[model samples]
Target: MAYTDDEILAGLAEIINEETGLETDAVQLDKTFTDDLDIDSLSMMTIAVTAEEKFGVKIPDEEVKNLVTVNDAVTYIKNAQS
Candidate 1:
């Protein structure tokens, strides 16, 4: 099923929480994965892989550069679902 942006964000929150051990509230749309979430390149790759598996959307490496913030990743997933 296709997901909305909010659903994508929530899924991402779960993934981030699992990977980073962060609180659900800490994974907000405005939070940057690198700066705010302290997600390094390796962690980001793991998140991206989890996201791909969960969302059933292929997020290519080239497209990963565009996902700087939580909102960016959610939007990318939503767009990909469409």
Candidate 2:
């Protein structure tokens, strides 16, 4: 089954928070993962892993690099789930 935007957002928050040791409530929709949340490559990779496992989806490498913001990850998750 596909996830809703809210569900995607929730999953992203959980994954990102867990990977970066940040609070989900601290993330903003427009915040850049790198600049704002301080999520590095390794952490992002972990986020990807978590997202893939949680949603049962594959995110392409090219698309992954382009994702800089929380919304970007949520959008990717939503599309992947669909």
Candidate 3:
């Protein structure tokens, strides 16, 4: 089954928490994935890996680099699902 936006967000949240040692509640959609969430380039690669493994989708590095916030990832997943 295709995942919902909430599911995508949750997946990203789990990845963030795992890589950054932060809880899901600490992540906000508007928060910058790097500056606000303290995610570095390497951590984002890890997040992309998690997303690919968990969702069975390969996230392009170009696409990943465009992600500035949790909402960016959410939108990408939703669009990919479409």
Candidate 4:
């Protein structure tokens, strides 16, 4: 299956909300996970694991560091689905 960037972003926002109690709208493309969302390392791991399961993508541990913003994660998952 494939997903659009908007779908990926919405899915990611839901995951982040579930993991952090943040509002879905608060998750924007340019928002940094750490600096903007205040997501700590532990929450990031949980989000990554959940996102992998939800999106059916293998987000390797090393690659997680590269996903700095919501756009980054959405783009990664969108590409992985291809």
Among all candidates shown, the one with the greatest TM-score = 4
- Tell me the whole-model lDDT of each prediction, alpha carbons only: 0.91, 0.83, 0.84, 0.94
Tens digit of per-residue lDDT, candidate 1, span 1-82: 9998888888999999999899988999999999998999988989999999999999998888779999999988988884
Under the 3 Å rule for N, CA and C atoms, how many clashes does model 4 have? 0
Q: What is the clash tally of candidate 1?
A: 0
- What lDDT does candidate 2 reach at residue 43? 79
| Candidate 3 lDDT, 1-82, residue by residue in tens | 5888888888888888889898998777788887888889998998888887888776898888998988888888777763
Cα displacement (angstroms), candidate 2, residue 25, comes to 0.5
TM-score to true structure, per model: 0.94, 0.90, 0.90, 0.97
lDDT of 2 at 59: 81
Sorting all predicted structures by lDDT, with the top scorer first, yields 4, 1, 3, 2
CA shift at 48, candidate 1, in angstroms? 0.4
Better of 3 and 4 by TM-score: 4
| lDDT tens digits, residue span 1-82, model 2 | 8898888888788877777778988776899988989888877887887788999899876777898998988887787765
- If ranked by TM-score, best first, what sequence of candidates would result? 4, 1, 3, 2
**Pairs clashing in candidate 3?**
none
lDDT of 4 by residue, 5-44 (tens): 9999999999999999999999999999999999998899
Per-candidate RMSD, Å: 0.9, 1.2, 1.2, 0.6
Q: For residue 9, give model 1's deviation from the true position in Å.
A: 0.8
CA-RMSD of model 2? 1.2
